[model samples]
Target: MTACGYRVGGQGASLPTEIKVIAVPAFENRTPWMRLEQRLTAAVMQEFIHRSRYRVVGKEQDADAVLRGAVTSATTTPVIFAPETGRASAVQVAVRVSVELRDRRTRATLYANRDFVFREQYEISSDLDSFFEERDPALDRLARDFAASLVSAVLENF
Candidate 1:
């Protein structure tokens, strides 16, 4: 009972407490990026492990629910324009993801949302080679932060 004079386990009650395991499937990527799926999947797994009360399982059969996600967009655009040749002075990388939560046993959707965007800006470098190399580290950081935010939002009932 939750102070409402209703049994917690009966109909019209609050959500059940038995759902504690989650399976994160490989995210489908609609973008041209070849490895975004792997990156996003890894980040989501890491976030769930770090901050959530639920346990993450690799197999859907082992979990109470499964979380399906898709990377809808990944793009890089010039943020600043160079005055000399009208070239990009800096670049911004953005990623958009859509997520769905479903019960594995009942096959019922619990939640779904889209257009979760995460972006990061990087300074332009004199050499293109160094720019690409440095981009990985920044992207990794951004992915981790984005995953954390997503997980927090889901768990907090947002």
Candidate 2:
């Protein structure tokens, strides 16, 4: 039992204890976005390093398990429009990602999600001079959120 005197799900719940090290490679970008995969991969690696007990490696040969990511689709849509010019005042970006984790020695699949999707909206600039490209920043935000959620999934064995 936990300090609260009640177990949440199971005793000592987590990924396999043997998985002491993890490797994360550059995500495969199936979409048109040039380096979105790199950003996402980097974010996930950073999250694991900061939040998990396992040692993270950049190469699969150095890890006990491997976490693979692939970006499937990305799209943008205008959510809010300027009343005067009919121009987009806000836009939403939707991204679909596939992720998998497997033990290197046993070759057993630990976790896999083929259709994970995340969407975020950012305000567009209607005023001139105030606009300075926000899609990149918005994507960074999305990557961070995705990484956190991914880490949680692994930690909980979800």
Candidate 3:
């Protein structure tokens, strides 16, 4: 029980107590977006470091367990269009990811999710000068949201 008397699902309630250190390597990018894996991997590592008691390491051999992930698919689709120019006014981005956490010593899988999906919607600027400017920031926000959800799910053994 927590101080509030009700425990949240991701307060390391299900994670093994012995897992004091974790390895988070660069996620594999199976999508066409270059360096997407790097961004996701970095976000996940940062989340683990900031949100949990586990120490994060770059190498698998130095950790008690390892968390591996891959970005499987990414797509951007126009969801809303401007009435005047018939151009996309808003777009929706969808991403699929695969994640796995395993114990190095016991060779046991702690958590596995092969089809984790995440989506975000961003407004497309009407001005040509700022059209592409929203993309990176949108992706950054998506990555952070994905990391938070992924960390919670992993911690809860969901």
Candidate 4:
């Protein structure tokens, strides 16, 4: 009988075996939104710490590998509107990023994506009292999601 080479499931750990420490710095923000980089960078660091086997550092000088990124663009557009008031009831936020993972010792890029785009939709509460409270949390959720996807892509080397 001929044997097929198909594997069972995901074979993780595509990074080099020598890479044990990773540095993740605050990504540069080119968008109009304030503190977007901070939130996204923090989320990525947290994801690596929680999900990966590598030790994460703040400075690139102290790590075996570096993950760098930039927030290239951000836009908010109304997706849903209130029928009675003819005003926006929900908004879709789209963020574009450029990310790269490089090996410090080898001076080679392990992974790079120049145009990673992520979008999330959030409901704009019609109640004025709770309106402002929803913005930060929604952004936080989006950042977390982006972080997870980025880390997965890097680890899987896709």
Return the top candidate by TM-score: 3
Q: What is the per-residue lDDT of model 3 for residues 1-158, given as tens digits with 9 covering 90 to 100?
A: 44765775566767788989999988999999988898899889999988888999989999999999989999999999999999999988888999999999998999999999988887889899987787788788878988998999999877
**What lDDT is obtained when candidate 4 is compared to the true structure?**
0.90
In Å, residue 155's CA in model 2 sits off its true spot by: 2.2
State the lDDT at 104 in candidate 3. 95
In angstroms, the error of model 3 at 22 is: 1.0
Each model's Cα RMSD: 5.7, 3.0, 2.2, 2.6
lDDT of each: 0.77, 0.84, 0.89, 0.90
lDDT-based ranking, best first? 4, 3, 2, 1
Candidate 2 regions with alpha-carbon error over 4 angstroms: 1-12, 128-132
lDDT of 2 by residue, 19-134 (tens): 88999988999999989998889999998888877898989999999999899998889999998999999888888899899999999989898987878788878766666576
**lDDT, model 4, position 99:** 95
Whole-model alpha-carbon lDDT for candidate 1: 0.77
Local accuracy of candidate 4 as per-residue lDDT tens digits, 1-158: 99896642222378898999999988999998999999999999998888888899889999999999999999999999999988899999899999999999999999999998988888898888888898899889989998988888888887
Error of 4 at 35 (Å): 0.7
Go through the candidates in order and give the clash count of each.
0, 0, 0, 0
Which stretches of model 3 miss by more than 4 angstroms? 1-5
Q: How many backbone clashes does candidate 3 have?
A: 0
